[model samples]
Target chain A: MNKILTIMWKDVRVLFQDWAAVALIIAGPLVLALGLGLVTGAFSNSDAPTIGRIPVVLVDEDGGQLAAALVDVLTSDDLSDLLAVETLSDADAARARVAAGDASAAVLIPTGFSDSFTPDMATGEMPASVTVTVVGDPGAPVGAAVVRSIVEEFAARADTAVAGVRVGLTQLAGSGAVSPVELPAVGQSMAAAVFADSAAASAASVIRVETRNVTATGESFNILAYFAPAMALLFLMYAVTLGARTLLSERREGTLARMLAAPVSSAQVLGGKVGGIFLGGFIQLAALILLTTLLWQLNWGNPLSVLLLVVAAALAATGWGLLIASLAANAGQITSLGMALTLLFGILSGSFVPLNDAWPVLDWLSRITPNRWAMDGFVALAAGEGGAAVLVPVAALLVMAAVLFAAAALFFRRRQGALLTA
Target chain B: MTTPILIAKDLRKTFGDLEAVKGISFSVLRGEIFSLLGPNGAGKTTTINMLSCLLPPTAGTAEIAGHAIPGDTLGVRRAIGVVPQEIALYDALSARQNLEFWGRLYDMRGQALTQRIDEVLEQVGLADRAKDKVKTFSGGMKRRINIAAGLLHKPQLLFMDEPTVGIDPQSRRRILDMVKELRDGGMTVLYTTHYMEEAEELSDRVGIIDQGRLIALGTQAELTRVVGEQETLRLYLAEEAGAAAAQATVAAGDGAALPADGGLTLFNGLPGVLRASAIDHQIVVNVADAGEALPAVVGRANALGLHVRSVDIEEPNLEAVFLQLTGRGLRD
Candidate 1:
C-alpha cells in the first residue's frame, strides 16, 4: 500500500510540475465555462429568453380525484405561460405524438394511480401504488424536461397529501370521534384539504419562474450550473488522459522498468498508476467545481452529494484513460487517442448542449459516457433536488467504471511482458 | 577467491522466432566488476533484463544473491539494483524528490531514507543541485542522478548497463572513477559496455559476447592469451583506395574474381600475417609479432597497388583478441 502511494504520489507530482499540462487541466475548463456562460447571455442584463408554452398530451386512464387534480394543475391559468395541455384517450397515441415531435411530452396517468392514495373503507388500507409515465420528445429536451419536473413535483405533493390523510384517519379512529363507517368519508375530506394546500405550495414554488427574465427557468437555475459541470467533465476527460499518457511515457523513458526493477510487484506498480490517474481526475473536477463556485458564485448543490458525483465521475473517467493507454502502443499514440476521446466524449455526452433524446441511438451512446451520467446528477442537485436524486446516476457511473476497468485490465494482462520489459 | 554472488546456467530468451539470448551461461564473483563487452544488438541488455527480473528467462535457471530467477523475483529484485542504458529519471521532478520516491519503493522511509538519499546524492556529486528539477540539469547530471536512484538501497549486486552511453568524455571519466570506487567499497558490479578500452580499464574479469553467445570469458590477460603473443598492425589506406581497387577489378570482368572482404584477402597468404580484415579506411592484421609482421604486411598492401598512408603496431589487447576470435573489430 505504501509503495503504491509512493508511485501514485510521484506521478501526481510529475503531472503538476508540468505547467502547460496543469494549465490545460485546471484552467481550461474554468475558462471554457466562463466563455460559455458569457455566450449564453447568462451575465447579460437582458431577460433570458423564455421558453414557449410546452405542448403536452394528457392520457388520463385513472379518472380519479387525484388524477383530476393533476390535470387541473397542468391546465391552470397560473401555469398557462408554461404548459399547453391537450387531452387524448389513447395512451399509445399520446406517446406516438411525443415520439413524432407533435408534442413535447405525454403524461400518462395509469389506472388506479389516484386510488392508490385512497384507503379502503373496511380495511383502512390503500391499494398498490401506480406511476405516472412521462414520455419526453428528444427534439425538445428543455420543454420535456420542464414537463417532467412539473409531474415529479405533483407526485411528491400527492405523496405528502396521502401521508396526511393516513395520519388523520388514525387519530380520528383512535379518538372515537367518528365511527368506522365514517372513516372513509373523513379520509377523503382530509385528503382534499391537504391536496389543496400542497397544490398551492407547488404552484408558488415548485414550477414557477420568479422573475420575468435574466435567466431561464426558476431563479435557482444558473446557466453556469449546467455549463460548469459540462466543461469541467469535458476537461476531466483530458486530465485523466494526461495521467494515462504517463503509463506509456514512463515505459518509453525507462522509469517503468526501473520501478519494476525495484522490490515492488507488477500489481503494485499498476495499482499506483491507477491510483494516480483517479486522484488526478478527482482533483481536477473538485478544483473546477470549487473555482467556479468561488469565482462565479454558482451554487452546485449539496456538498456531500457533489463530492460523491465527483469521485464516481473521476473513477469512470480514469477507466477510459486506462482503456486508451492499454490500446495505444506508445506515449505519442496515447496523446492522440486521449485528445480524440476527450472531444468525442464531450460531444456525444451533450457537454456542449443538452442532447436531443429524439435519437435513440445517440441517447444510448451518451449513456456510456461518464459526462452524461455525472451531468445528470449535477443538474439535478443544482435544481434543488436532494442527494437521493443522484443515487441512480452514481450507481450507473460506478458500473461503467467497473466494466471499463475490467476491460483495460484484461488488455494489460495480455501485454504484460511487453509493458514491464526492455 | 571470492564467492560467486550470481550464477546462471543456460539462460535463454526468445521473442517470437528471434532468440535474443541464446543459452548463455556465466557468474559474477562477489566484490568484482564483471564486464560484458558487446556491441549493440549483441543481447547484453536482454541478459541483464532477465537477471534483473524485468524479463523471465525462457529456458534455464539462475540464482542471484541466493534467490532463483523464475521463482523468487521479489527476492532477486530486493538484492539487486538496475541502472538501465537510458537516463530514466523523471525530468519534471527534483533530484531529491525522485530519489525519495525510489527509496520509498524499496521500503526505506523517514530519517533513514532521507540520510541515504543525501549520501547517494553526495556520492554522485549532485548534492548541491538536489533541489533543482532534473529538466534543469545537464544530460550528464541527469545520468548521475539516474545512477544515484539505483544506489539508494545499496543492494548486494548493482547492474550498470552501459551507464556511460551518451555523455561527454569528462562525465564518462567521472562515472568510471565512481564505478571503481564502488567496487573498492565492496559492491559487486555487473557492467556492460561496447567500448574495449572501458572493459580493459574497468573489469576485473571480462566476458566477450557476440550474436547472443559468450565467445570468450576470463581476466584480460587470460582472454588475450587466447591469441598467444599476437600483435595487431593497423594499415591506414588513403580514401577508400582498397575498396576502389576491388570495384575496378569487378568492373573489368577480368575473370579474376574479387574476394568479398574488400581486398583484405590479398594479405591472407603473407608470412607472419595470420588473418586480415577491413574496417572503414583501415586494414587490421593479426600476427604473432608486430616487429616480424609489419614490413611484410605493408609490403603486401603496396604490392596490391593500395596506398598505405600510415601504420600502427599495437600489443595484445581485447580488440586483437576479439579479432582473432570473431574475425571482426569490437566496433563492427
Candidate 2:
C-alpha cells in the first residue's frame, strides 16, 4: 500500500508539474463547452423569429352596398393589424398571390351584397348565400386561421344589425303605439347602407383575439434546461481523453517499466495509475461545470445528484482511458484511437445532439456506450429528479468501468515480463 | 576453495539453430578479477549473460555466488550486480535521483538510501554534478553513473560486460583502475573485454573464446608458453639489397648451412642462428638467443654490403601463442 501510494504521488506530481497537461485537462474542456453552448444559443435565438404578422390578399367582386361593407370590415385596422391585407382585382389573382407565398389567405366577396341583408330574403332560403371565397396558403395554418377569424367577425356583426330592426318593430306593435302603415319603409336606403357599412367596420375593430399556447401536459420548451446536461457530459468526455494521455506518456518514456521494477505489485501500479487519471478527470469536470454555471447561468439541478454523476463519470472515464492505453503501442496511436472512439461514442450517446430525435439505430447504439449512460444520468440530475432514477445507468457505467479496468489489469499482467525486457 | 564465487560447467546456449555459446566452462575464485577475452561475436557476452542469470543456458548449469542458475535465479540476481554495455540510466532524472530510484528498487531507503547515493556519487567523481540531469552529462559521466547505479546494492559478484566499449583513453584507464580497486576490496568480478591489454593488465585468469568456443584458458605466462622457446631476429635491408647479399649475410660466421627452402637458411649446430628467411627486401632470422644473435645478425648484414635499415628482436607473447593455438589472430 505504501508503494502504491508512492507511485500514485509521483504520477500526480508529474501531471501537475506539466503545464501542457494541466492546461489541456482543465482549461480545454471549459473553453470547448462554453464556446459550443454560446454559439448554439446564438444561432437558435437569432433564427427563431416570433409569430407577429399574417399576410392576406382580398378580392372584392360586388359593386353593391353589402360588398362595400364586407370590404370595409376586411380592410379595417383591427383585421389589418393581425393580417397584412392586399387588395386583388379577381379571385384567380388572389389565389395566385396566396400560392406565391405573398399572402397567407384571400377573401373573395360575390356580387349579391345588399340582397342577403333584406329581412324577407334572410327568412327565406338565402340566394347564393352572399358567397365569400377564402383562399389560403397550404403551409401557413396560423395565417389562414387569423383570416378566418376576421371574416367570421364581419358576418356576425351584419346579422346582429339586421336582428335589432326586427326587435324594435315587434316591440312597437306589442305596445300598440302605432299602426303597421305608419311604420318607416323597410327598403334599403343610402344612409342605412352607409350606416351598416360603418357598423361592420366598427365591429371588426372591436373584435379581440386571445391566443393561448397550451400543451397536452401544460409545459413549455426551455432550451437551456434541455441542453445543459448534454453539454456537461460532452465536456466530461473531453476531460477523460486529455487525462488518458498520461498513460501513453509514461509508457513512451519507459517510466512505467521503471515503476514496475520496484517492490510494488502489478495491481498496485495499475491502481495508482487509474487513481491518478481519475482524479485528474474529476478535476477537469469540476472546473468545466463551474465555468458553465458561471458563464451560461446553468443550473445543474441538485448539488448531491450532480456530485454523484461527476464521480461515476470520472470512474467511467478512467476505465476508458486505461482500456485505450492498454490497446495502443505508443502515444500517437493512443491519441488517434482514443479520439476516434470518444467521438463515436459521444455522437451515439447524444452528447453533441439529442438522441430522442436521432435515428433508431443510433438510439440502440447509445445503450452500449458508457457515454450514453453518463448523459442519461446527467439529464436525470439536471431535471431536478432524484438521481435514483439514474441508478440503472449509473450501475451500467460502474459495470463498464470494472470490465475495462479488469481488462487493462489483465493486459498489464500478461505483458509485465515483456515490458521489463523492453 | 570456499565454493568458488561463480562456476560454469560446460554451459551452452543456442538461439534457434545458431549456437552462441558451445559448452564453454570456467570458474572464478572469490575476490578475483576474472576476464573473458574474445572478439565481438565470440560468445563472451552470451556467457556473461547466462552467468548473471539474465539469460538461461540451453545445456549445463552455472552456480553464481553459490546459487544455481535458473533454480535460484532470484538469489543469483540479488547476489550479482550487472553493468551492461549500454547506458541504461534515465535521461530525464538527475544522477542522485537515478541512484535513489535504483536504491529503492533494491530495497534501500531513507537515510541509508541517501547515504549510499552520496557515497556512490562521490566514488564515481560526480558529486559536484549530482543534481544535473543525466542527458546533460558527458558520455564518461553517464557511464560512471551507470556503474554507480549497479554498485548501489553491493552484491558479492559483479559482472562488467564490455564496460569500456567506446570512451576516451583516460576514462577507460580510470574504469580499469576502478575495477581493480573494487576487486582488491574483496569483490569477485567477471570482466569481459576484447582488448588484450585490458585482460593482460587486470585479469588473474584469462579465458580466450572464439566463435562460441573457449580455445584457451590460463594465466598470461601459461598462455605465452604455448609458442615454445624460439626467438625471431628481423633485419630490414636496404632497397637495393639483392638475393646474393641476403645469402652472404646468412652464411657469414657461425651460421649453419642453408635449408632446402632457398629463402630460408637453416643453421644447425651453430652458436646462434637456427633458421633464416628473406622475403620482400627484408630478412627474418630465427635465432636460439635473440639477445645474443641480434647484434651478430646486424653485424653480418652490415658486412655483406647490405645496409640495415633497422633491426628488431622479438620474444614470443600471447599474440603469437593465440596465433599458434587457433591459427588466427586474437581479433580474428
Instruction: Indicate the TM-score of model 1.
Output: 0.83
For A140-239, candidate 2 gives per-residue lDDT tens digits of 5335644664566566666666566566656765688745654344323322543454545534443222222212232222234334555555555655
Lowest-sum lDDT 10-residue window in model 1 chain A = A206-215
lDDT by residue for model 1 over A339-362, one digit each (tens)?
998898888887775555445577
Model 1 lDDT, residue A235, Cα: 93
Q: Cα deviation of A380 in candidate 2 (Å)?
A: 5.1
Model 2, residue pairs in steric clash = none
How is the predicted docking of candidate 2 categorized under the CAPRI scheme?
incorrect
Q: lDDT tens digits, residues B1-332, model 2?
A: 24488888999998889999999888888988888888788998888778766567899998877789768766777788877777766676678877876676567879998988898888888999998888899888888888888788887888888888888888888888889988888888889988877998999888888889988888888887766776766577776333654456465742444433343433233467765555456566666688877766776666666778888777765554554555444553
Q: lDDT of all predictions, in order shown?
A: 0.85, 0.67
- Where is model 2 more than 4 Å wrong at Cα? A1-27, A34-38, A41-356, A359-394, A405-422, B1-3, B41-49, B52-54, B165-174, B195-197, B223-332
CAPRI category for model 1: medium
